[model samples]
Target: MMTAVAQDRLGGPDVLYLTRRERPAPGFGEVLVRVRAASVNPIDAKTRESGAFLGDPPFVLGWDVSGVVEATGPGVRLFRPGDEVYGMPLFPDEAGAYAEYVVAPARHLAPKPAGLTHVEAAALPLAALTARQALVDAARVRPGDRVLVHGAAGGVGHLAVQLAKALGAHVIGTARSAQHPALRDLGADELLDFTEVDVHGAVRDADVVLDTLGGPDAFRALDTLKDGGTLVSLPSPEDDGVIPTAAARGIRAGFMLVQPDPVGLHHLTELVDAGEVRPVVAAGFRLEEVALAHRFAEAGGVLGKTVLTVD
Candidate 1:
């Protein structure tokens, strides 16, 4: 049996409780991982609050997983028992990563980059996937392109800043004044103090803008894009009222609900090995402190990633 941080109800972090269940074994094409670390993302908090994605009571949370393969199921060739691996497991609904062991698809994972510790690798999957998908796949960042990211110092924002720069895009980011220097060091060519500067006023005609802060800002982002430039947000604020404005401006706007991408994970592993993109963790907690971590995540506005050591 192994202990897991679980929640039996849909509510605040206080709902989280510890439970011990039989350690699961891998099925065909899967591997059982002895989890060493897990990173907490905004999705986890929202899911806990709404229970929108989680099943009934007594569900496991957490998406990011970094661990060693303790057992491999039949036909699993990518990794052997005892090999280190990291990946974001099937997220949104079930991942069970905030536990000592989890079973995951072999293809969904890759060799944990030797360059990063388990905590660091654990921090990469969910946020890094969001950044990678938005900056590379959705935004189509190119050499000499200009990119703007909202919430520059936050989990996904910081990674987006660095990933855009790595793609040769000139990146600008918006954050509080206190975080400006940290954003710059993370490869933001320019940092706009959102506390003082108007986002639409200061940024104009970018190739792409990643609006990590969704809601009313969604409508504001449309004005910053040049003709045909894109505004990708986590939520579509004006669903009832946004399309006509985009039609009037000729600027396309849409939301990207990030999904798992194995190829992208493999690529990020390379970036980790090359020292181009490093995981930035603000702090870490043990699995037992998950309730406290969720309370903190619910309070919002943390710099970098917050992680949980599961082992």
Candidate 2:
């Protein structure tokens, strides 16, 4: 048996509770991970409340995991039984990472950076991969390009700032004045206080804009980009009315859903090892305190990621 946080029905954070379940085993090309830590993302909260992408309850809510490989199934070669690894496995599908053990496709994970602890490693996968995919793969950000990140002090936003900088772009970020120094330290070249100033007017001619905050905020970001620039909206869907407006304005706009990418995870590992990128964990709760953790994550105003210690 393995310990896990599960919900029998869809509702608030109160719906979450601890339970015991059969320990999962790896399948073909898969690995069984002894989860040491897992990070809570906004998707987890949304799924918990409304079944977002999950569709129902009686489900485990976590993707980000940092752990030791316990066993390998057929055709696995990337890791051994004792290797330490971290990843956001199965993503929109459930990998059941909020447990003592999880079975994941071997290709969905990468070696945990040696410089980081399990908690820090757990914090990186989903949020960091979102930033990397948006900036590098989707936006195609280039050296000296102007890259603007909305919600720059939040989970995905903070990592986006550092990644844009690492890609050699001049990174601008939107956050409260209180977070300016921290964003600057993370390599953001310009910091805009969204509460104090209008972001559309404050930043202009950005080569790429990562819209971490969806809705009207994504629409507002259109004016901040130069013609032919790319605007990648992370939280919003494609049909949110931003795409047509972007086309009319000679800009490219679309939404991106993060997926499990071992290659991207390796690149992130390189960045972390080289000191170019680091995940900021706002808080951590034990496996039993998942409900409290969910409440904290849903309450917003978090500096970075929230995590759960499975041990």
Candidate 3:
């Protein structure tokens, strides 16, 4: 048996409780991971509230994991029993990473970056993959392009800033004044104080706009883009008019969902090893304190990711 954090019903963080369950064994092409750490994300809280992705109770919630492989199932040739690995497995599905053990497909994970500890590596998968996919794959951000990232100090935004910089794009970030110094150090060329400035007016003619804020901000971001620029919305736009609005402006706009990709994870690993990127772990809680971790993440203003360290 292993300790797992699960919710009996969909509601507030209080619904989360620890329970003992039979250890899950890896299936074909999968490996059993002894989780060392996992990160909490807004999706975990949202799903806990509405059961959006999960249909019923007694389901584990978490996608980010960094750990060592304990065992492997048939046809799993990528990793051995002691390999240190990390990934966001079965995302938008039940990954059950917030537990002492999880079964993941071998290809969905990559080697843990040598520069990062388990806690720090736990912070990378979902957020880093989201940022990398949005900027590199979807938007095709290129060198010398003027790229603007909304909500720049938050989870995905901070990584986007560094990635845009690493890809040679000129990156601008929008965040509260309090987060300016960190964003600057992350290589954001300009920092816009969204709380104090007219964000749309402060910037214009960006080659690409990465909208992590969503809703009205996603629509307004179109004004900051050039005629042929692209706007990638990481969050689902609250309004349905985003597409039509972008079409009218001769700009391309779309939403993105991060997926598990070995290629992308390998790229991130390379960047981490090269010192161009790093994970930011703002806080960590024990496996039993998952409810507190969710509540803390929901309270907002956390500079990086909140993680649950499994003992």
Candidate 4:
């Protein structure tokens, strides 16, 4: 039997409980991984609240995984037993990463970088992929372009700031004044204290804006961009009325849900190896304390990711 944190109902962190089940086996082109670390994301808490993404209870609530390949199933060629790998697999669906073991498709995972530990690697997949896909694919950021990142101190935001910088854009970030030094350390060219200033007014004519905070906040980001600039909202791109707003303003805007991208993971590995990007693990808990981890993540304003470790 293997240990996992699961919930039977949807509500708050209190809904979570630890249970044991038979270890899962890999199918064709899949591998069974002994999970070492898993990172909690905002989506996990939101889904736990609404049960929107995961339909019912008795489901696991994690996507980011870093572990060792314990066994490979039939026809698996990408990896073998004893390999160290990391990925955000089966996103928007349960890969059951909050467990002691998980089964993932071989193609969704990439080798763990030598420089990063399991906890750090686990933190990178979801947030980093979100940042990469949003900034590179959705916004198409380019050199010398002015890029503004909303909520630039949290997991996705901090990485977005750095990724924008890595892409050669002049990066501007909106964060609390206390987080300014950390964002600056991540290569943010300008910092806006949203708590004290009108962020839209302070940051005008940005070539691209990465909105990690959605709803009215996303709509507010439109004014910070140039007429033809792009706004990439990480949360609820369609429901926020961003499409029509962008059309009315002659700008481009869309929501980006991160996917499992091995290529992007490899690119991130390169960046990490080159010392250009790193993940900040703000807090950690044991596998049994997943409910506590979720509570901490839901409380908001955390500097980076909260992770769970399994023995």
Candidate 5:
């Protein structure tokens, strides 16, 4: 049996409890992983507490996974037993990577970058995919572009800033003044202290704006965008909203939600392998401490990704 955290009812972290479950076996074209680590994200917090996406309790709460493949199902050709791999498993669904073993699509899994350890690799999947999708697939951030990233020191923001730079864009980031140095270290050309300065004034001439805020007021921030620039929102935006104004200004906007994509994970592997990107782990909790991890994550803000170490 594998140990995992599950909820009998949706509420708070207290509803989560450790329990034993039968070890999972890989399905066709999948790999059964012996999990080493998993990372916590706001999605898990929202889903677990509200049961919004989960639909019910007694469901697992994890997506990011880093582990060694212990077995493979028929038709799986990408990995063999004992191969170390990492991936963001099926999202808004059963990933169950919080347990000792998880079954993931073979194509979704990638070789953990040689430079990253299991714990570090565990922190990258969901956050990196979010940033990568926003910048590359949605905004199409390109060379010589001036990009602005809101909440830039948080889990996904930190990586987004670096990714913008790696894509040859000049990146500006917004965070508390205390986090400016950290953002700068991640290659942010400028930092906006959201507490003191107007976020719009801090960033002008933005060729691309990666907005992580899903709050109702975030649409107002778009007024600062230049004509023909792009805005990539990480949240589900309202219909007939940001788009009309963008079209009027000859600007483009993308309401992008991240998904598990094998191609993207493979791309991330290259960036990590070359030291062009890095995963910052803020804190790690053990499997039994999953509740504490959830509590810490919901406390408002964290400098980097909060992770749950399984083994």
Candidate 6:
């Protein structure tokens, strides 16, 4: 048996509670991870509150996981029992990472960066992968390219600023003035206080814009991009006319959903090990304090990621 956070019905953070269930075992090409830590993300809270993506009750929230491999099923060769590993497995599905144990497909995970602790590693997967996919895969950011990241101090945005800089792009970030020093230290070439300045006028000719804030903010980001620039919107599934508007402006605009990618995880590991990228942990909570963690994450104004430790 294993202790996991489960909700009988979706409502709010109050719905999350600890319970015991049969310990899961790995199937073919899978690994059973003894979860040491998990991170709370906006998606987790959104899913818990409105069933976003996970359209039902009675589910465990969390995809980011950092731990040791407890067992491996047949055909699994990438990792052995006792190996430290981390990944966002079965994203948009139930990997049940907010538990004592989780079973994940072998290809969905990679070696945990040796330089990072379990808590820091746990903070990387979903948020880092989202930033990596958006900047590297979707935007195809190149050296010398002008990249702008919205919500620069937030989870994915903070990572995006670093990743874009690592990719050789001239990174710009949007956040309140208080976060400017941190964002600049993260390699942002320029910082915009979104509260005080009009983003569209303050910055223009961006080669790529990573929009963590959806809706009108996303539409405004289009104006900041150059004629052939790309805008990758992370939130809001409804197109809501931004696609056609972008087309008319000769810009590329679309939404991107993060997926399980072992390759991306490996790349992140390389960056972390090389000292080029690091996850900023805003707070830590015990596994049983998941409700509090959810509340903290939903409250916003976090500098980086919130983590849940399982001991």
Expressed as tens digits, the lDDT of each residue in 1-311 for candidate 3 is: 99999788899989988889999999999999999999998888888998867878779999999999999999999999999999999988999998999999999999999889999999999999999999999999989999999888888888899999999999999888888998889899999988899999889999999988788888888889998899999777446898888888788898898999999999999999999998778899999988889878888775788999999
Q: Which stretches of candidate 4 lie over 4 Å from their true place?
A: 239-241
Q: After superposition on all CA atoms, how large is the RMSD of candidate 3?
A: 1.1
List, residue by residue over 107-159, the lDDT tens digit for candidate 2: 99999999999999999999999999999999999999999999998889999
Q: Which residue runs does candidate 5 get wrong by more than 4 Å?
A: none
CA displacement after TM-score superposition, residue 175 of candidate 6 (Å):
1.0
lDDT of each residue in 134-228, candidate 6, tens digit only: 99999999999999999999999999999999999999999999988888999999998888999878898999999998988888888899998
Candidate 4: tens digits of C-alpha lDDT, residues 164-205 = 999899999989998898889989999988889999878889
Which candidate gets the maximum lDDT versus the true structure?
Answer: 6
Task: Name model 1 segments beyond 4 Å from true.
Answer: 236-238
Selected candidate, larger TM-score, 1 vs 5: 5
Worst lDDT 10-window in candidate 5 = 214-223
Q: Which stretches of candidate 6 lie over 4 Å from their true place?
A: none
Worst lDDT run of 10 residues, candidate 6, spans: 235-244
Backbone steric clashes in candidate 5, count: 0
Estimated TM-score for each candidate:
0.96, 0.98, 0.98, 0.97, 0.96, 0.98
Number of clashing residue pairs, candidate 4: 0
Worst 10 residues of 4 by lDDT: 234-243
Error of 3 at 274 (Å): 0.2
